[model samples]
Target chain A: MIDRLAVIGVGLIGGSLARALRAAGQVGEIIGCGRSQENLELALELGVIDRYAQDPAIAVRDADIVFLAVPMGAMRELLASIGPHLATNALVTDGGSVKNSIVADARVAFGCMPPWFVPGHPIAGTERSGVGASFPELFRQRRVILTPLPETDPKATARVRAMWQATGAEVSEMTVAHHDEVLAATSHLPHMLAFGLVDALTRMDCSDEIFRYAAGGFRDFTRIASSNPVMWRDICIANRDSLSAMLARFSTEMSDLAASIRDADGEHLLEVFARAKAARDGFVDGGKSLAEHN
Target chain B: MIDRLAVIGVGLIGGSLARALRAAGQVGEIIGCGRSQENLELALELGVIDRYAQDPAIAVRDADIVFLAVPMGAMRELLASIGPHLATNALVTDGGSVKNSIVADARVAFGCMPPWFVPGHPIAGTERSGVGASFPELFRQRRVILTPLPETDPKATARVRAMWQATGAEVSEMTVAHHDEVLAATSHLPHMLAFGLVDALTRMDCSDEIFRYAAGGFRDFTRIASSNPVMWRDICIANRDSLSAMLARFSTEMSDLAASIRDADGEHLLEVFARAKAARDGFVDGGKSLAEHN
Candidate 1:
């Protein structure tokens, strides 16, 4: 059990984690920290955190585990603030979507990558945000990916994994580069497509009729387009290289698809669509899609 | 009241309409026709249809209304098969996703776009298809677009509109060209993106881990990828011009978004994301998303 846990940026991610730990009876005292005093008070009143701190440094002081759940753009400053004040035995982790940037920030903040700093990301979210939008069940049956640096302590990683496991999450580890690239394919690029598609329609088609007539499938398909924009922006910039590369590759494929349509190549369209359907059918039918929980 | 109704292709779309009409007591002598005799039998057994016919011609011989719900690829042949046999006073409409191709097919088969043929599309569907998946509530609170020709009988259009209204759908009308363009922007393009994205990832990534670790949001966003591949390929081929144009425009926008990411233009990214979110938020909150029904 965590004796004292510090969760900086106590919004959806951190607030949900705090609630999960509280529900599991796995934590002693949870301290919520964020730039928003009102949000922190809300978190405290909701019992998501036992107390609150406005500063990351004070929040992490003497804490057994410090979880930085702030947006990616704020991670560098957060790392710098908490590095000097964290207990020597304290384990530091994060819920940032991108790993390489967090690793880079840790390296710069500590002058060397500390063995206690374990970078991680929980692969779960909704089109909702804020402390009020969080719940203990958010991480249940979800995947939590950890990208531990080479110099990180194995015990730190293990403890982090155990903490996530207590919340009913499946945890695994991968290299920072691989995590970012894979996430680019699965998470980041999808967000970009959703955002870009809606934006394009809004700009090109002056009529709101375009969206009005969009079917239920389109609504479900573009649900992610309603996600928090600032957090996604920070993520886009943090994982720029992989996301940009994926977007370039996707754009080329789409162009090719357009050419096929132009050439009236129903055969090629059927081939690609059939293969895609097979992949998703297998995944969703496997009973491990994690789609049911959400 | 209708004395008889012939529903060619007794799958999700036609079967759902049959069930809805029966629930409302608005249809009589529902005749199911399809190439799949087993499926047609199932529709009859489930009460989605009152009788089964293997041939469209035989099915519509005395029917007062004919609702063609076959794939776009099959619509042309089905039109030809039923044209000579349709009742002289029949009101014929279709649930084809594309209007222009269906209209063109009717012109070729009947030697003219018949006054009784009202081209219509009900903007409702799920990834699941087949007669077993049909339900009376499929079209509840959904939008159905009708594109009636200038020569089409106004009484036929009004009756078709009333039939859909009986299913608790909000019915609207537009020209054939506008209907195809709007659907291309809203439905067709999103399907292409989902299918293409999944297909691209499967080809590039060798490990099944990409699909295994995909989050709930990713699964929901790509749910449409699991839709009937043959049907989508047919839609793509039928609405080639509009879909191709939309895809080209979307690919360009995606390329531009990628450039912003490569250049680290977080502001531009945030603006696009925020606007897109607003559009969806308004639409979903407006209680017209129809996502709740599905």
Candidate 2:
């Protein structure tokens, strides 16, 4: 059991982790840390955390485990602030969507790859955020991917895996680069397309009529465009290389589709659309299994 | 109040219209016409129509009103087949997504815009199709747009509007060109983006991992990619001009976003994202009213 667990940035991910640990009797004390006093207080009142701290260093001073759940852009600053005060044996992991940058930042802050620093991401979340959105079951049956450095201690990695398992998550390990690339395609690129589509429609001369006549298909396709802007902006910049490559690839595909339409090439358009439908069908089948597990 | 109502190409839209008219007691007889024997049989068994016919011309022989609910690409063939057989006083309306194509096709087949020909589009549907998926409430509170030609009889247009109203739909009128332009932005462009995204990911080397790790956002954003390929292909070709214009505009926006990401212009990215979020929020708010009406 963790004697004390410190969670920096007590929002949806951190608060949910704290709640899950408490329910599983895996942590003796949970300390919430954040720049937002209101969020920390809300976490305390919700019983997701046992106490609160405004300073990251103070929060990690005596903690047996520390989880940094802040936005991707804030990871470097947060790691530097807590590096000096963290107990030498404390197991540290994160819930950031992007990992390469966090892993690199950890190297800079700690002077080397810290054995106890296990870079992790829980492949679970709603468009909603903040402390009030926290729930103990958020990670149940969800995939929590750990991208451990070569210098990481096996014991620390196993401990982090076990903690996530206690919350009913399936933990898997992969290289940091691989994790970033996979997420860039599946998550980040989709968000970019959604935001771009909505932004494009907003700038159209017939914007009002377009929105008024939009059917359920349009609504579902652009639903993700309503996600938190600042958080997504950070993600876009943090994973720029992978996301930029994906954008170019997607643009090429779109251009080909446009050409087919322009030329009235029904056969080519049907071929692309049929392939996409088949692929989407497979994805939906796979998603059902994932949904059942979660 | 209609003596007879014939619905050709009985599928989701046509079958639903027949069912809604029956529920409202707006027709003396309902004749379902389609090429698919199985679909017509299902519609007959479901009592969505009072009878079934394999020939469109024979089906509309003595009908007071005839609804052509076929894909945009099939509009020309269907119009040609039924034009010579249409009753001189029969009011003919269609549920085609693209109005300009249907209007032009009707004029070509009939030698002129028949005074009774009214092109209409119901801004409603689920991804699922076929007669089995039809329901009486499909068009309730939905918007049914009527695009009447200059030669259209005002009496016939009023009757068509009244029939849709009896089914609980809100009927509005717009020019054929305007309707196509609005739907090109609201519906066709979004579908193209969805199909393009899915097709792009399918061509990736890590396609399996991409689909496996995709979250709810990806699922929601690509749900429409699984829609009927032939129908969407037809739409892509029929509304090529407007949809192509929208596609270019969207590409420019996407390129601007990519440039922002490459330059690490976080402020610009945040501004674009914030605007999209606000627009989507307003859309969701407006959509709530539309949802309530439907």
Candidate 3:
């Protein structure tokens, strides 16, 4: 059974994991690694981790499991630095939003795609980021989709799934490519549209007063536009191909809607809105885990 | 002093106004009118009004203040029926979102612009509709923008403004045309985009799974899409010209962002996200009043 665990890049996701693991008594000790000494200190002070390490490489030593909780762009550098120190028997995984690029990089950094390495994308998070926002139950009732390549070690995959389940997340499996495409349609594309909507709204001359008078409708539409830019930037670039395809498709749909509106086709507008409302209601009723805890 | 007040529609907005007037001891007797007898009965039961009525003409009789709180599309029809009954000395105001069309219709219905008619839109509401959701404090700390036409009476406008102040709402004035244009960008466009985004995302093959896996981000983004579609449909049609113009502008900007993604331009993507982040932060810091009460 896995006992000791190390978490790299102790931000919102990692810090939450540490808190959840410790609260559930799922791990004997949790080690935190980050570039910011102050954040590491804060994590230790909050008892989110049992120890802190300035060097990423040494942080993984003697750990039975390690999570690379950093951004996708930083994953390769992080994996390269920690690769030599990783015990062959230790299972490695990630909480990245995108998977294909990370999976490819992990294969390169670990000599071959180690059986102990599993790629995961937890479909949960908040607009707020950082260690301060970390909560133990952040992932409670949330889905954690794992993209296990064909050569993945069965035992390693099982351990990873068990660990996620212990943290109160429902575990599901998909191929790396499928995960990317699905997330692009559901998550990434929505984010891009939100950001684009806000940008469009703000440029209007009277938007300041308009935003002031904005009801719950505007607030909800622009919510995702308030997310962390750097993280989203990386995700968009890392999964550029799929996201681009999704965006193209979305643009076509939007153009059609706009045309219908221009033509004063009330029937078409109502049809689209009704379809969306029904689909959204159906999804909510289906009861999927919205986020993973810890 | 406005001794008798008539509130048309008796839904959340009208009921809340009636309740506030009674709660503040501002009106001698409040008469609530609506096509829905059940809604009027419940409004009286909830103490939202002092009495109820079925006919627009009878409700406005001898009323020193008359508030038209029906849906935007119904405003013209209501005004036509009540125009003959509106006392020349009475202050006639509305709770409609779009002002230009309503104001124009009011002018035509009265054969000339009634000096006492004032057009106002309160920038406050909850997701729940109908009289049951009405509360005295719904307008507190919220904005109530008034758009008084050139022919509006000064005394009538002052009376309406004072009434809104009694509910603790700050009143601001603008032209009806400008108000419609501004709201199209801020309120209408956002709802349209949110509905479209939710609709687009939920139609995917894994929609049920995606909805199940949706986090706070997706929830927030689509929350507004759950609003009453008929109300939104009326709004879009009432302000179709401005909404269509705003949508065209928004589409142009969305296309630019889509083009950047297609080219895999990380720098451009980061720049766009960064700008949007800053804009949202600035908006929040500006103390703009889009705060959700629920």
Candidate 4:
């Protein structure tokens, strides 16, 4: 068990992690650090954190473990601020969605690959945010991917993995580049598409009528459009290369679909649509088994 | 009350309408007609219809009202066969998603504007199809848009409106072109995007991994992709012009978004995403009120 754990930028991810560790009785003291005093107060009152600190440096001074759960935009500055204060042997991990950039930023901040630094991302969250949205079971049965630097100490990685396991998360390891690429395709690109679709509809002359007549299908398809704009913006910029490639690929597919419609190519349209349906059906079945196994 | 109701293409839409009419005691007899004898028999056994017929011509022979609930591709042929059999005073209507084409097809099939022809579309359905998936309350509290031709008799329009009202659907009237345009932007475009996204992923070398790691957001966004491909393919072709226009517009927006990501234009991305979130929130709020009123 960790004697003291420090969580910077105490929002949904950090707050949830803190709460989970407390419930598991795996951490003796949890320190929450954030720019918003009100959020830290709420986290403390909710018992998600044992204490609150406005300074990241002070928060990690005596901590055995540190979790940087801030947005991608804030990761570099926050890492720099806490780098000097973290105990030499403290295990460092993060819950950022993008990993390559974060790992690079950590390297620059620490002046090298920090043996104690273990980059991780828990693939779990809802559209909600802030301390009020945190729950002890948020990471239960979720996938937490750890992408450690080559110079990282194996013991530090093991400690981070054990912490996630204590929170009921299944931990898996992958390269930082692969984590970024896979997430860009599965998560970032989807959010961008949703945001772009809704933004496009809003610009139309018949925008009101379009939204009024939109059925349940449209609503579900664009649900992620309601996600946090700032957070998503940071993700898009951080994973620009992979996401741009994905966007271009999707645009090509859409263009082909449009052409099929224009030519009334029923056979081609049917083939593409049938393939999509079968793929989605397979995904749903696989997801069910994953859930059952978890 | 109608003396007789002939429902052509007895699948989800037609079977649901017949069941609703019977539940409301609004029809004397319900005749189900379809190419699939097994589906028609299922409708007969479920009491969605009182009898079944293999020939559309014979089905509408003595019926006072005929509802063509077939796909867009089958509409022309079915209208041709039943045109000569429909009673002179029969109120002929349809449940096609795209109204402009159906109305145009009706004119060609009938040799002129038929005063009894009304084009209607119920903005409701699940992913499942066939008569077995039909239910009496399928259209209850749903919007049923009716686009009547200029030559349509006011009495015939009123009769069709009242029939839908008896099934607990809210009926609204609009120009055929307007209905097609609005639905193309709201429903057709979203479905095509989902299909295209799924199809694109299947083409990737990491297709299996992509699907395996897809989260709940991806599942919800692509749920409509699992719908019947033939039905969607017909929709894409039937509403080609409007859908193509929408596709071009959406592609432009996506390109702008991609540019923002490539340039790391966080402000532009945030502005677009924030606008989308606010719009989606408004739609959700409006939908809740609509549900409450219903």
Q: Give the top-scoring candidate (TM-score).
A: 1
Question: Between which residue pairs do clashes occur in model 4?
Answer: none
Order by TM-score, highest first: 1, 2, 4, 3
Question: Model 3 over residues B29-53: C-alpha lDDT tens digits?
Answer: 8898999999889988888888887
The top-ranked prediction according to DockQ is: 2
Model 2 agreement with the true structure over B33-110: per-residue lDDT tens digits: 988999998888899888988989899999999998888898898989988898888889989899888888987988
Across A40-153, the per-residue lDDT of candidate 4 in tens digits comes to 999989988889889998999899999998889999999999988888778789999999899879878988988899999998887778999999899887788999878989
Candidate 3 local distance difference test against the native: 0.82
Candidate 1: misplaced stretches above 4 Å?
Answer: A287-294, B288-294
lDDT of 1 at B208: 84
List runs of model 2 lying over 4 Å from the truth: A23-25, A292-294, B291-294
* DockQ of every predicted complex: 0.84, 0.85, 0.59, 0.81
Give the higher-lDDT candidate: 3 or 4.
4
Worst 10 residues of 4 chain A by lDDT: A83-92
Predicted candidate 3 versus true structure: per-residue lDDT over A56-97, tens digit per residue: 889999999999898888998888888889887888999999
TM-score of chain B of 4: 0.97
Clashing pairs in 1: none
Query: What is the lDDT, from 0 to 100, of the residue A156 in candidate 3?
Result: 86
